[model samples]
Target: MGVKNNIIAAIDIGTTKIVAIMGEIDSDGRLRIIGMEKTVSRGVKRGVIHSIEDTIGAIREVVDRLQAKSNKNISKVYVGIAGQHIRSIKNRQFKYIQNGVGEISKLDVEEILNENFRIPIEVGEQILHVIPQDFVVDKEAGIRNPVGMAGRRLDGNFNIIIGRTASARNIEKCVKEVGLEIEELVLEPLASSLAVLSEEEKEAGVVLVDIGGGTTDITVYFDGILRHTAVIPFGGDIVTRDIKEGCSVLIKQAEALKIQFGEAVADLVDEEKVVTIPSVGGWDPKEISFKTLAQIIQCRMEEIIESVKFQIELTGLHDKIGAGIVLTGGGALLRNLDVLTQRKTGIDVRIGYPDSTSKIILDEALNQPIYATGIGLILNGLNKPIENEKDLGNDKDTGSKMNLFKRFFGAMFDTED
Candidate 1:
C-alpha cells in the first residue's frame, strides 16, 4: 500500500442497499479491500435518498460493521451518487482576456471550466461533475490539459453531470448523522467504470452496463472519453417478479431460484434438465423444466440488453465499440448473461467483476460481480484527495479536495473504460 493510503472508504448508497467499503490504495494505485459491510438500504428509492432517518440507520450499521471488522478509523468517504435526478449535458465554456495575446494561466483554465457550473437548470438541480474533454485556445481545438499553455482566450468542452440539490442534501444529512462526512459524491456509473474497465478496452471503445436491483445503468466510451450514459427502469427485480408470477412462487423464493439456478439464455440449458420448485402451501414440491426457467430469464434480460443497445445506437457509437459490452451488478451474476448480452447486441460481452487486490477476509462475497459498484466507489475514492489529509495541504488550508482532476493529475487513467 502507498505510504499515504492508511485507510480509505467508499460508500455506495443504492436503492436496495447501502454498502461501505474500506480499502488501502497501494503505492501502485491498486485498491486492496480490507473492510466491507453492506446493509439493506432504507429511505432510498430509484437511487435517491428519500427518508433521511432510515437511510442514516442503514448507513450507520454498514459503517460500524466496517469499522469493527477492519479496525480502520473511518471518517471521510467517497460516496456514489445516482438516481433519476442525475443528468448529463455537454457544453463549452468561454473565458475572456484583456489582451489579445495574453498567456493563459491555470486560474484562467479554472475560470473557463467553472463556467460549466453556470449552466442553467431547475431550481433544485446542482452540477455533480464538470468533466473537461478538451480545450480550444484561440480557436485551436483538441488541446488536452490546457494548463501551462499560452492563449489569448480559453474555452473548455465538458460533460457536466448534475442532480437534484434536495437529494444531495438528504444524502449529506444521512452520512453526517452516521458520524461520517461525505468527502465526495461521484456518479455511480462513472465510479463503476473506473474499477472494472481496463485501458485497452476503453480506448478500443466499449459499453459498460451495470444492472442493479432497481435500474440498469449504461455508460459508453469512445475516443477515450465517456460518450453516453442512460438508465433503464427494468433490472433484476423485473426478472424476479416475472419468475414469481410465472411459477406462482413467492418473491423471496423467486430471488433464491435466480441466484441458485437462473440462466439468462435458454439455449445454454439442456432441455432434459428439470428442477423442483417448492409448494406454495403444505404440498409436495413441483418439478419444473429448467428450460422454462432459462427461457423466462432470457426474455427479460434480452429486452434489457436490447434496450441498452438501442441507447448505444442512439448515440451513433454502436459501431465503434471494439471492446463490446461489459456487464456488471447483481444482474450480471445470472448464468449465461454474458453470452446472452453478446448475442443480443451482436458484440463481445464479458462479466464486470471487482478486481479483488485486497487481503480482507470478506473478499469472497464482495469479490462477486454484484459488489462492483461498491468497490468501484472505493477505487474512485482513490482519485479524490482525502479531506483534512494529514499534513498534505499547506498552511493556507481548507478541508475540500483539490479539484475534480486532482486524482488524475499524475499517473492517471489515460483512457476511459
Candidate 2:
C-alpha cells in the first residue's frame, strides 16, 4: 500500500535466531506489526558476528522472506547490537552558554551531549550512545529537560555506551553486503527495555534482564533514565550445553529437552517424571529423569542469576529497585525461572513480554518473550527518522541525515575511533 519508505523495519540478529520485522505507526502512534519472519542464526555467537559469509546468508534469508511477504522493497533497517564487549560509563560535561542570560535552547543541550563524543576512549573502542541522565543549570540540579530554562552555566550527566570497533564494523559489513543500511545501531538492552518497561516502573526503578541464546543483557533505570547497562557472556546456550554433556544427548535433543522439560528449580520437579530420548547412532534410547534435567538447568541458571545479582550490586541500586526485576527473551521461558530469580535476588521478579507496551500492536503469536528485542527494535526506530537511499553513503559526520539525527534525537554517530 503506502509508500515503502515510510515503513519502519528492524532486524534482530540474535545468537539462535535472526528476526526481520516491518511495521507502521498507526494514527494513534502505535507500531502495528505488518510482517515478521525468523530463520536459524548462523555465524553469530554471543551477539557478535564471526563469519561474514554465513551472517550475510542468514540476513538475506530473513530479509528476502520479509520483503516477499510484505511486498515492499526493504532498503534500510534499524539493527540491535549486544555482546560481552558492550559496556557503559558515566561522564559529566560542563559548558558556558554563549548568551549567559538567555534560556537554554536545544542547541545548547545538543552541544553538551556532543562533547561527550569527544571524550577519550580506549583505542579500538567506539562510542555508540551518549544519553543525558540529568541536567543542572545555574546551580539548580536534577532537570530532565532544560530547553526553556534560563541558565548561564549548564552541566549535564551522561551515560555513554562503548563497544569494540571491529565488532561494530563486522555488523555493518554484513548488513551492507546484503544491500541493507543500518539506520541506527541500538544497544540490545536499551531496545528490550523500551518494549517491556513501563514509564512508571522506570520512574520507580527497575532492572531489565534479557536472557537470549548467547548473552544475558542487563539495563537499570531509575527516575525514568538509564543508569547502567552490561552484557554478560553467558545465556541459555550454556544451559543447553550443560544438558548435552550431563544427559549424554545431542545438541538438538538438549535444546528440545530444555524447551519442553527444563526447569529452573530442581526442588519443584517430581522425582517420578522423566523424558525418553530416542536412540541415536544405533544406541539404545536414554531416559532422563525430570529432576536430573532440572538439576542440570538449575545449576547453570543459578550461576547466571548470580552474575545478574552481582551486576545489580555493582549499580548500588539494590534497595532502590521498586519494581524488582523484569526478565525477557527466549531464555526467560524456562519453567520456574521467575521463581528462581526472585528467590536468589530476594526481590520480586516477573517475566517480561513485548505486549507490555501499548505502543505495540501485537497478535498472540508475536507476543512471546523471545520477540522482545525484535519488537523493541521497531519501537526504537520510531524515534529515528528513516534514511534516504541517496544519503546512505555520505560521510556520517557531514551528512544531512546525521544532522537531522542530532537536531531531533540528540544522538551521536562516531565515524572514527
Candidate 3:
C-alpha cells in the first residue's frame, strides 16, 4: 500500500495552458488520476517560455489547485515538452561481428545502440528519443526484436527525435524552480500519441496531429514504429489573430467570436445569419454577417491544414496511414476540424481523447481534449513494468551491486544519473 501511494505528476506546460495532473500507480499497474488542474498560461507562446516569472506564477496556481483537489503532495513530475524547435530524423547503425560469430548476445546489441547515439548531430540539438524502426540481418530487412538470431552482422534503423538544447534546458530549469524533481520530459505530441493511440492503430500505421494553442505537432508511426516527427509553428492562435485583423476587431473579441461561432469551412455558414459586435466607442452596435466571420476563420484554418497535408506528403507517409489520422489538442476540439483535416489531407480523421481508455465518468470536465497531454504523460509511465514485478532471488546483490567495487571510493551523492 505504501509503495502504491507514490504519486506521479505530469506538468504539461503548453503555450495557452498550464496543467498539472497527479496520479498514483494502483495495484493493477494503471495510473488513477487523483488530482488535475489547468490554468491560463502566461508568458508562453508556441510552447516556449518567454518570461520565467509569469510562467512560474501559472505553474504555482495550477499546482496549488491540484494539491488542494486531491490532498496529495506532488513533488516530482514527468513534464511534457514541445515547441517549433523540436526536430527528428532517421538514422541507421551497423555493427560487424567481432569474431564472425555463431550467436549474437544482448551485450552486442547494446554496444551497437550505444554507438548509434554517437551519431553526429548539431551542437545545440539534444537527443530525446531513439525509437527502433526495424532490424536488418544480412539480406533480411524487417526484423523486430532481433535479440536471439545467429547473424554475423547487426543493423538497426531508428528515428531519432532531437530538440534545441536551450529548449531542453529551459524545460528543466522551469520545472526544478517549482520545487519539483524532473522525472522525465515527454514530447507533447509523442505523449499524446501514447495516450490515445491503440495497438491496432500503431500496427496498422497512423499519423497523429496535435493542433495545440500556438503550434501543431506531427508524429507518424508505421508498423508500430515512429517514422517522422515535426513541429510546425502554426495553430489556433493564428486563426484568432487572422480574425482580429480580418474582421477589424479587438483581439479579445476576435478570440471570443472564433471559439463561440467560428466555422472551419466558409461554405457551411448560413448567409442570413449575422453576429452583433458591441461598438468600440459605445456607438451603435454593428452587426457583422456570420458568413464573413466564418470566411476569415476558414482561410486561416485552411492554411494551417494545408501545412499539415504538406508534412504528410513530405514524409512520404501519405499513403502509409492505414489507420488515418488521430487529432488531439485544444485545436482539435474546434468544430469540424476533423472533417476539414480529412478533406484537406485525403485521410480519414477523428478527434482523439484520453476518455477512450479512461474509466472515469465525470461530467465531461476532465474529459475535454485539453487533458490529452497531461493524461498521456501519466499513461507513459503507467505502461512501464512497475507493478506485477516481483523481486528476483537475492535482489540486493544483483543489478545494483555490480559496480559496488568502483563506488567504494566515491560518495553515494556523487553517483551520476
Candidate 4:
C-alpha cells in the first residue's frame, strides 16, 4: 500500500458531471489510480456554477463515495475550471538584471512573472493563470530557461488566462461548503492537454480541442510552449439540444440517440435505417431516420469544427501545427468524429484517450476521454514544484515528473477485483 501522504485527489466540476478521483504516486513514482466517483451535475452549466446549493450537494455525494471507496479522508484537492467568460491574452514585460553583467537568478524571473498579475483587466475579472511562453535574455529571443545565463535584462512573454471573479468565488464557496479545500484552480484546457498530449506533439505544434458538455476548451501549443487558450460557448450540450429540437425528442432521448447512433458525417449513415424513440404521455412512438439524425449532428459538429479552425487560425499557427488536431472529451465519442474533423480541417486528426501514451498507469474504466480532465488534475498537482508556491503564475513548472518517466514503458498498475 502507498503512503497516505502521497495520495493526491482532484475534483473535475464539469457542466454535465462531477468527478472525484484519488491516486497515489508510488515509490517507483508512477501515478496509480486508487478510486474515482462521478455523478450527474445539477448546478453547473457551460463550466460555471450557477446554483451553490445544488453544486454543493453534488460535490458532497461524489466526495463521500470516493472516500468510502478509498477508505481515506480527503481534505485538499486540485480543481479544474473553464467557461465562456474565460479568456487568454498575450503580454510581454522586461526587467533589468540585478548588477548588470551578472548571471540572472531565479528571483529575476519571478519578478517579471509576478508583474503579470498587475496587468489591467475589466472590472469584476481577475487573472487565473500566467504561463510563461518564452524568455529573452539580453535581447536574445526564444530562450526557455535563462537561469545562470549572463544577461543585462530579461524579457518574458506570457499567455495570461483571465476569468470572471464571481465564477471562481462560487466554485470556491461550493467546495468549502462541502468540507474541502482547493489546492489550485487549474484551467481545464491546460489540464486536458497534460493528459492527452505527448511531449513530441507539443514540440511539433498541436491543437487540443476538449468538447465538454457545456463548452469546448481549446489550447494551442507550439515549440513545446503554450501559445494560446480559448473557450467556445458551444459544446456537446448544444448538439444534444439540436437533436432534441430537430427530431422532436426529449433531451434524454436525444442524448441517448447521440451516444448510441449519432454520426459526425451524414453521408456515412444508412438512409434506410431508423430508430423508434419512446413516446411520452401515451403518444405513438416516433421513428426518425438515422440519416436525419446524422444530418442534424453533422451540421452542428461542422460549426464546432469551423470554430476550432478559426481559433487555430487566430493563433497564427494553423500552418505550423505538425501534429494537427487531437480531439478529446465526452463529445469526441461520437461516431466518426475524427474522420469529420480531419476532412473539415484538412489536417490529420485523432481521438485522444487518457491512455494514448505510456505516461500514467491506465485504469481500464478511466481509459475513456470523459475522464481526461479529472486524471490530468492529479498529474498536474503532482507535477507542481514546491518553489512555485511563491510564484503568482501557473503552469510554469515542467521539471522531470518525480523521476517517473523512466518506467514509461513498464507502467505499474493496481486494480481491485
Candidate 5:
C-alpha cells in the first residue's frame, strides 16, 4: 500500500451511475489506479442530486467498496458536477497598477480574477469556476502569461461557469452525510476534457462532447484555452425514452435495445432484418423491423447533434475547430455514432478515450470513454493544489457553508472522541 497522503480519490455521480476511484502517484509522477467501483445511480437525475438520502446511500456504497478493495480509509474526495442549470458567461475585468509602468505581479493577476466572483449573478445561482481565457497588459492582447511584464494596467477575459446554488449544496450535503470531506467540486465537462483531450488538439481548436446518461456536456477549447462549456438537459436517457415510447417496450428493454441494436443512421439498417423483443408481464415476444428501431434512434441522435452544433456556433470558432469533435461518456458507445455525427455536422469525429498520460496499465473496461471523467478527476486532483481552509472561505460559488459545518462538526466530533 502507498502512503496515505499519496492516495487521491474521486467520485463521479452521474444520472445513470456513480463511480468511485482511488489512485496513487508513482515515482515517475504518473498516476496508477489502485481501486475503483461503480453502481447504478438511484437518487440523481441529469447530473444533479434529487434525493439526498438516496444519493448518499449510492455514494456510501461505492466508497465502501473502493475502500474494501484497496484496504485504505477514504476520507477526502474530488467530485464532478453538471446539470441543465450549468451555464457559462463571458466577462472582463482589469486592475490599475498602483505605480505606473511596474512589472506585473501574482497579486495583480489574483485581483483581476477575484473581481469575477463579485460579479452579480441571478438569484439562486452561483459561480462554479472562473477560467482565465487571456490577459491584456495595457494595449497588448493575447498574452498567455503576463507575469514580470511591465504594464500600467492589467485586463483579463474569463469564462465563468455558474450553477444553481441549491444544486451544489445538495451534492455537498450528500458527500458530508457519508462522512467524507470534499477536496473540490470540478465541472464535469472540464474534468472530462482534462482526461481525454490532448494539448495539441486544444491548441489547434477542438470541441469535446460528453453524452452521459442524463445530460450532454459540451466543452470548447481553442488556442489552448477553454472557450465555453454547457450542459444540455437531454442525453442518452432521452433516447431510451424515445425507444420505449416508440417500440412500446419496458424502460430496461429500451435501454438494452439501444445499446445492443440501435444505430444512428436509419438508412444503414437493412429493412429485411427484424429483432424479436421479449414482452413484459409474461407476454409473448414481439417482432419489430430493425429499420424502425434505427429510425427512432436516428431521429433523437440528430437532434442531439444539432444541439451540439448550436453550442459550437455560439463560440464563433466552429470553423477553426481543426481537430474537430471528440465524443466521450457512456452514451458515446452507441454504434456508428461517430459516422452519424460527422454526416450531420460536416466535421470529423472520433470517440474519446482517456489518454494514457497517467501511465497506468488499466483494464480494458477502464480504458473506455465512460471512465474518462473518473480518470480525469484523479489527474486534476493530483495536478491542482489542494484548497486550504482560508481559500474555502473565499469560494462563495461552491458549497463554502458546508465547509464551515465540516470544520465545526469535525472539531465537535474530535472533542467527543
Candidate 6:
C-alpha cells in the first residue's frame, strides 16, 4: 500500500459488525470517502470488547481490506466506543480570573475544562468526554463563549460521559494488538448524531436513537446543545434471540427471519399468512404465522421504545422535543419501526439516514443506517484539528501518531454541553 499521511481512517467496532473507513479532505473541505469495508464482529458484545484476540482479528481484517481498496497504509485510526456501562452526568466548574486581568482568555477557558477532568469519578470509571453546555461569567449567565470577555469568575456547566476503565483499556489493547495506534475514542451515539442529525433538528430539540446490534444508544439535543446521552442494554440481537426461542429456530434462521419478515407492529400483520421454517436433520418443517412473528418482535420493540421514553422523560425535556426522535443504526431499518416509535412515544419520528452531511458521498449500498457510525467516524477524523507535536507523547514516531488523536479527546469535548 502507498504511504499517505493525509489519509484519515476510522474503525467502528459495533456488536454486529466492524466497519473501517478511509477518507481524505478535498480542497473544498469535503471529506471524500475513498475506501470502506465491514465484517461480522467477533469478540465484541454490546459495543464492548469481550475477547481481545477475536476483536483484533475482526479489526485487522476490515483494516486490511480498507487499505487494499484505498491503496493507503493504515497506521492509526479513530475508534468508537459504547456499551451498557456508558452514562452521563452534569457538572459545573469555576475558575477565578486574575485580579488585575479582568479579561478572560483562552487559558481561563481551558482551566475550567481542565477542572472538569479533575472531578471525582467512581473508582473503576473514567471520564470519556467533558462537553461544555454553557458558560457563566461572574453573575451573568447563558454565555456561550466566555473567552475574550471580561469577568472576575468563569463558571462552566458541562456534561461528562463516564465509562468503565477496563472497557476502554480493552479497546485500546485490541487496537494495539492489531498493530494500529489509537487516534481517539469517540462515543458511538455522538458519532451517529454527527452522521445523521441536521442543525435545524438539533436547534429544535431532537433525540437521536441509534439501535445497533447489541445496544440502543440515545443522544438528546436541545437548542443545538447536547443535553443527555444513555445506552440501553437491549438491542436488535435480543429481539433476534426472542425470535429464535419463540419460534424454536436456529440463531442464524432467527436473524434472517427478523431481517426479512419482521414487523414492529403485530396488528399490522395478517394472521392468515404463515412462514415455514425448514427443520434440521430429518425433522419435519414447522409453520409459524406472520402474526406470531410480528407479535414477538413487537413485544421487544415496545420494551425498547419504553426504555427510550424513560430516558427522554429523565431529561425533563421530553415535552420540549420539537424535532421529536430520529432513529438510525441497523435496527432502525425494521419494517414500520418509525411508525411504531411514533405511536409509542406520541412524538414525531423518522428513520435517520447518514446522508445529512454534504462532506462525503458514499456508495448507494453504504448510505443506510447501519453505516452511520462509520461515516460519522470518518467525518470526525477529517475535521479533527492538528495538535502540536509537543502536546503528543515524547517518542517521535509515537508522538506524531498520538498527536493525530490528542485534539479529538481534548478539544472535541469542548462541544455544546
**Per-residue alpha-carbon lDDT of candidate 6 for residues 214-309, written as tens digits (9 for 90 to 100):** 999999998777899999998999999999999989899899899999999999998899989887887689998889999999999999999999
Report the number of clashing residue pairs per model: 3, 0, 0, 0, 0, 2
In candidate 5, stretches whose alpha carbon ends up further than 4 angstroms from where it belongs are 1-4, 99-101, 356-361, 386-417
What TM-score does candidate 6 get on C-alpha atoms?
0.92
* Candidate 6 error regions (>4 Å): 1-4, 387-417
The C-alpha lDDT values of all candidates are 0.76, 0.86, 0.75, 0.83, 0.83, 0.84
Candidate 2 C-alpha lDDT tens digits along 92-184: 999888865577776677678778889999999999888778889989999877777778899999889999999989999999999988877
Encode model 1's per-residue lDDT on 1-417: one tens digit a residue. 212555678789887778888888666665677877888876887787778889988988998888898877787888887876677888988887654447776556656665666779889889887776778888899877666566777788877788889888888888888888776788888888877787667779999999888788899887667777778878788899999888778888888888898898887789998778867678678776788889889988888888998999988988899998989888888888888887778999888867632322235666677788887776766655443445323422221323455552332223321
List clashing residue pairs in candidate 2: none
Query: Could you tell me every candidate's TM-score relative to the true structure?
Result: 0.88, 0.92, 0.88, 0.91, 0.91, 0.92
Candidate 3 or 4, higher TM-score?
Answer: 4
By lDDT rank, best first, the candidates go 2, 6, 4, 5, 1, 3
lDDT of residue 315 for candidate 2: 87
User: What tens digits encode model 5's per-residue C-alpha lDDT throughout 1-417?
Assistant: 222377889999999999999888777767788888999999998888988988999999999999998998988888888999998899999988875548887657656776888899999999878777888999999987776788888999888889999998999999999999887788888888878888788889999999999999999999878898888888999999999999888899889889888888888889898889876699789987889999998999899999999999998998999999999998899988999999999889999997635445466768889998988877776643335434332545433433322321222112211
Question: Stretches of candidate 3 above 4 Å error?
Answer: 1-6, 98-101, 280-284, 358-363, 385-417
Q: Which structure among the candidates has the greatest lDDT?
A: 2
Better of 5 and 6 by lDDT: 6
User: Each candidate: RMSD to true structure?
Assistant: 4.0, 4.4, 6.8, 6.1, 6.9, 3.7
